[model samples]
Target: MCQRMQMPIITSRYWNMVHGTNPKEVQQDAEGMQVMQVLGNNMAFGLNCKNVAMKMGLSMPEEPEFTYTNFIH
Candidate 1:
């Protein structure tokens, strides 16, 4: 969805998901925790870069009008 909207997508070392039936189980997933940390860092870095660019007068391109097509119709 973000890609369709031309929004930046942040990625990590693996699929952004954690397997758990509860909070405690999730906390025990070492690999998932690492992925989350990487994702957080990536997001922070991307935001910082965007902020610096804006400060320098750089901006994203204007979005074009979107057209929706109904397959059922």
Candidate 2:
């Protein structure tokens, strides 16, 4: 979906997920916490970069017109 929308997809060291039945259990998942942190940092960095680019008068690429296709008649 992100690709289709030409949006940046943030990622981490692993899948952005935490396995737990409760908040306490989730807190125990060290790896999951790390992944979340990494994702957050990445997103922040990306946004900062975009902001800087805009300040420099850089603009986003123009989006092409969309074409629809139907298989059913």
Give Cα distance to truth, residue 24, candidate 2, Å.
1.0
User: Model 2 — TM-score against the truth?
Assistant: 0.84
lDDT of 2 by residue, 32-55 (tens): 999999999999998998889889
lDDT for model 2, please: 0.86
lDDT per residue for candidate 1 within 1-73, as digits (tens), equals 1223276899999999987999999999999999999999999999898889879998677777788988995
Instruction: Show the colliding residue pairs in model 2.
Output: none
Clashing pairs in 1: none
As a whole number from 0 to 100, the lDDT of residue 17 in candidate 1 is: 90
Which sections of candidate 2 miss by over 4 Å? 1-5
Which lDDT value does model 1 have at 43? 96
Report the number of the highest-lDDT candidate.
1
Candidate 2 at residue 70, lDDT? 100
